[model samples]
Every structure is written in C-alpha cells, then in structure tokens.
Target: MIRAVLFDLDDTLLRLNLTAFIARYVAGASRLLASVARTTPVALGVPYVRAFLAMDAQDREDSLTNEQLFNKTMLEACGIPLDDPVIADLMTYYEERIVPGFSSGVVAARPVPGAREAIEAVHDAGLICALATNPTFSLACDRARMGWAGVDEKDFALVSTYSNSTRCKPSTRYYQEFANQLGVRLEECLMVGNDAVRDIVRDGCGLRTAYVGHGRPRGAVWRGPMERLARELPDLVARLDEQDA
Candidate 1:
C-alpha cells in the first residue's frame, strides 16, 4: 500500500518552464556580475555560461555535489587559481545576488491547473506527501518554488533541498535518504514527476512512480495526457488502492 507521495516541483506541480527560468537566471547573473567586474554582461557571462554547462555535463558522470562542481568550474572558467580570494568574492556575489533573485521570481510560481486539488485529495486519503526535487537548490529556493506552485511549506512531510540532502536524483542514495527521513519503506511510496530520468526511473530505489507528461523529452513507463493529469488524480489513487489489495 502506498503511504506517501513524492513530487517534483518544476513543470509538474508548477507550470514554470525550467529552461526559460535558467536562461533568465543566467542573464540576471551576468548583468549583476558585469556591474562589479568592469566588463560587458555577455563578455563576463560567456565564461560563466560555458563553465556552468561544463559543470552540468560533469554532474552526469561525477559524484561531486553541485555546489562543489560549480565552484571548481567557475574558478577554472574565470582562469583564476583555485582558492583565490577573487573567486570567493565572485561566488559570494553570485549566491547573494543572483541566487536570491531567482528565488524571488519563483515566489510568483504558477500551479498546474489541478495540482492543488490533487494534493488535497492525496492528503484527504490519509497519505503523506513530500517534494522530492533534485537537491541542487537550497531549502529557501525550494520553498519559493512551492509558494509559486500554490503549495504551502506545511503541505509536505519533508522537503528535500541541497542543504537537506547529500545526493542528487537519479541516484538511489538521494531517494533512499528521503525514504529514510519519512520513515517509510520505498515500496510504500509513490514518486510523481515530469523528468523520466530523474523521477520515474528512480524506481530502481523501490518507489512506484507516475510520470507527469509535460517536461523534458523522456520515455515514461506510463504516460498520461498533460491536461488530464490533475483531473485523473482520483482515478490514479483508486488504481493504487486496488493494486495494494
């Protein structure tokens, strides 16, 4: 029997286009950095962008935390020696200015049409719910996104953020940590999200999964039409109940 439901934030419960958010975030960071670095936004941004992309690529194969990879890549891209004071300053600026701006914007998040109702339904069914987004962001940022998604912080039994987790998603360690925190066996949890690679495929860790159909291109074990996703929550719950019998 499923005792809990875990969700992905972006493009699942929330309707914000993540790719667009990233582009806007990068642009904001570049503009902010340029103001202090005495360089054009694009000029300063180019290296950072290249480094960021490189770090993302490395993340696929490397076990380093996202922050670690980001710092190392930023230093390398800026041609600054590791542990340089300037690098520290730049990192501080990025976190203080750029990161906060991104969070603020997320506070204005849009919820999927039936997301709120679905979550309420889950709660009413006596099941626990949590947000299991990839742990690359801080809790504050995650909260901001939740706010945008029309979900209250109290709605989740646990909210996994980078600060709360040591492993990123698609990694069984990450899902395991969440399962541990909630005091639930993996078999009793259901993960619902839009990313196939990160969310659904995590079934290897033992949680059942439901694929929300609107995000990155990926094959889902089960695909439901986007418009029907929220509307079908009741039916989904019924199916789960029947399966558990």
Candidate 2:
C-alpha cells in the first residue's frame, strides 16, 4: 500500500530552461567577479564554470559528490597549481556569490499546469508527500526552487537537501534513506519525476514509480499530461487500499 509520494524538483515540478538560466548566471557572476579578480571576466570565470560543470557531469557518471570533484577539476582546468591563492579566491567567490546569484533565478519557476492540484489531491488523501530532489544543494536552495515550482516547504513531509542527506538521487541508498525517514516502507512509496533514468528507475528499490513525462530530455519516452497524473493517483491509491483490506 502506497503511503508516500516523492517528487523531483527541476524539470519535474518546475519547468526550467537550464541553458538560459546557466548563461545568464555565468554572465552576471563573471562581471561581478572581474574587478575583484583582476582578470578578464570570462578568462577567470568561464573556465571555472566549465570546470564546475565538468565535475558535475563526472560526479553524476561516477557517483561522486560535487565537493569531491570541484577543486581538483578547477585546479586542472585553470592550470593554476592546486594551492594557488587565486584558486582559493575563486572558490570563495563561487560559494559566496555565484551559487546564491544563480539560485535567485529559481524564484522565477512556474508550476507545471495542474501539478499543484495533483499534489493537493495526494495530500488530501492523507498520504505523505516528499520533495526528493537530488541532495546536492542546501535547504535554502531547495526551498527557493520549491517556491518557484509553487510548492511550499510546508507541503512536504520530508525535504531532502544536500545539507540533510548523505546521498543523491539515482542511488537506491538515498531512496531507502528517505523512506526510513518518513517511516514508510519502500513498497509503499511512489517516486514521481521527469527523468526515466533517475526517477522511474527507483522502482528497483521497491517503490511504485510514475514518470512525469513532460519535459523529458532528448530520446526519452513521453508519458502524458499533469491531469493524467492527477487522475492516475486515485487508481494507485485504490489498488493500495485493496491491498490493505
């Protein structure tokens, strides 16, 4: 019997043009850091950004954390020797300025039409709701994204952020941890998100899974509308209700 629903944030509950957000943030951060760094904005900034992204891509593929890969990639990309004072300053700048500035763009998130209604229906049924976003960001960052997606922090029984989780999505360990936190059996949870590879695959961990379908990346199977999502939950609940009976 399903007792919990977990939702992925970006491109799932919230629609985002990742390329646009990244470009705008990089440009803004580069300019902001230029005067202080005493270098051409792109010269210092773009390489660091590229390095960061590279590290992220590598981390996703290798199951490493962002911090584990960031500094080494940055040092290698900049060729500035690992212990350079400039590298230290750049890291400081990124953490202090760039991350927060980029996060500000998330405030522009608009809910996928009907997503709020679907979530409301699930909540009304007395099932637990969770925001199971990849735990690579702070709670403040997750809250900002949730605000953009039209989900309040209050809506979730559990909100998984990097500060609060030791693992990330696509890892069954993370899903299990979330289930444990919510006091729900893995088989009694539904993992809902846009990514088939990350979200739907959580079914392997014993959770029922729903692919959000909209906003799928290239070559992904399309599911359908948010209203269909809303419509489908009752059937799932009915099945679980029968199992309980």
Candidate 3:
C-alpha cells in the first residue's frame, strides 16, 4: 500500500554525468568561496570537500542539524574559530550562487525520460510525492535540479534538505523521518530512485520501494528505466491502492 512516492533528485529524475559535474562543481565552488571569503583557496577547498563527505558518513553520534555539523566540522578543519565570518559567508554563497550556477554551466541538468509524466501519473492517481534527495544540499540547489528535471517546485509535498534531515541515506531513520513528515505510516509509502545502495535502503525503514534502472535492485517491485516506470506505474499504483484497501 503506497500512499506516497519519494523520488530521488539526481540521477533518478534528472540525468547527470557525475564525474563531469563534480569536477566542475568543486572548481567553481572553490573559486566562488575564495572570491567571497578572501582566503587561501586550496585550504578552504579541502575542508569543504571533507565536511560534505563527513555529513554523508553514517555515524549517528549527535542529532545536530547539517548546518551546525558542517559549520562546526568545517571551521575546525580550516583552523578557524567559532566566530569567523568566513563560514557564514560560505553558507550564503551556497544558497545564492552554488546551485544556480551548477544548473547553468557547471552541470547542465536534463530530465530523465518520462520523469515528469511518471510523477504526474502518481499525482493523477491521488498519491502524494516528495523530493527525497539526500539532505546534504541547500533547498536552492534542489530547486535548480528540479527545474532541470522539468518538475515545478510546487509539485513536491516536501523537499528534504540538510537543514531538516537529521540522517543521510542508507540510514533507515532517514526514510522514517520523511514518512513521518507526510503523516503517513512508512509501510504505506514507496521510495523510488536509481541508487541501489542508498534509495533502496529505504525499505529497511519499512516502506515498500521501486528501483529505477542502472541500480541493481534487491527485492524492489519495479526494476527498469524511468520510461518503464511511466508505462507501468498506473497499474502498479492501482495494485497498491487496491491491496491497501
């Protein structure tokens, strides 16, 4: 019984050449931070990368928001103090420039085939939807990526961001938290994405799931490309609806 659909942003709904995007993003982001903070570019860049990776780490010691953890960890790695304005400036740049620029030249995002229609199909069937991208990014970044996927920001019921999500993917709590947000039981939702390791791990949180292609699915109900999802989802959703009833 799937009352909601959780869609992963990158690679699932939008097509991204990961290597090319990361190379450009790191370069551009480092440059932008250097210009704004007027710091040693290489020094700032290393901590930036490390901090982002650290956020993705599954060690659940504390429940600090991603901003607090990133700021604290990044400042320590950069040999800066708690009161430094550079950290503040870096966050501002992230929200204002980073993602907008990513969607522009650094990594031009394009929609995966049949993505918009599939989402629309879910909505047409009276199911709920959310953007379940890993919350290590700012909302602006998610919105920009959504644009490339041909999805309007208004379409999602919830957009997960580091500001709100306490755990990263592969953590069952991450899936649980999103289900809680929708005021629905986890067993009544479907996590739909391409990342076999991360997105499909949502099943551990008690939700049903469908695996989009390029990911080796373990026990997902649907396994294929976005085009396949578009074709099969109407029937699949109906099955779930009837089964739940």
Q: What is residue 163's positional error in candidate 1, in angstroms?
A: 2.9
Per-candidate TM equals 0.71, 0.69, 0.88
In model 2, the Cα lDDT at residue 53 comes to: 61
How would you encode candidate 1's per-residue C-alpha lDDT over 2-77 as one tens digit per residue?
7888888887888875766666666766776566556677775667676556443523665665556655675666
lDDT of 3 by residue, 1-245 (tens): 77888898888999877666666656766666666556766767688788788788898688887756776787778655423677556756665665555665536578999899889888887889888898887677677778878898788899999878888997888888888998888878888888878877634456767888676676687788888887889898778778778
Once fitted onto the true fold, the runs of candidate 2 whose alpha carbons sit more than 4 angstroms away are 26-108, 214-223, 240-245
Ranked by lDDT, the better of candidates 1 and 3 is 3
Q: What is the TM-score of candidate 2? A: 0.69
CA lDDT, candidate 2, residue 165: 52
Best by TM-score: 3
Full ranking by lDDT: 3, 1, 2
Q: Count clashing pairs, candidate 1.
A: 1
Model 2, span 1-245: residue lDDT tens: 77888888887788876556656655665665565556666775657676556543513554444444544565565544424577546645564555544545543546787779878878988889898987755566576667767888899989886545545667676778788999988878877787776675423456666767645543222255666878777776777568667
Report model 1's TM-score to 2 decimal places.
0.71
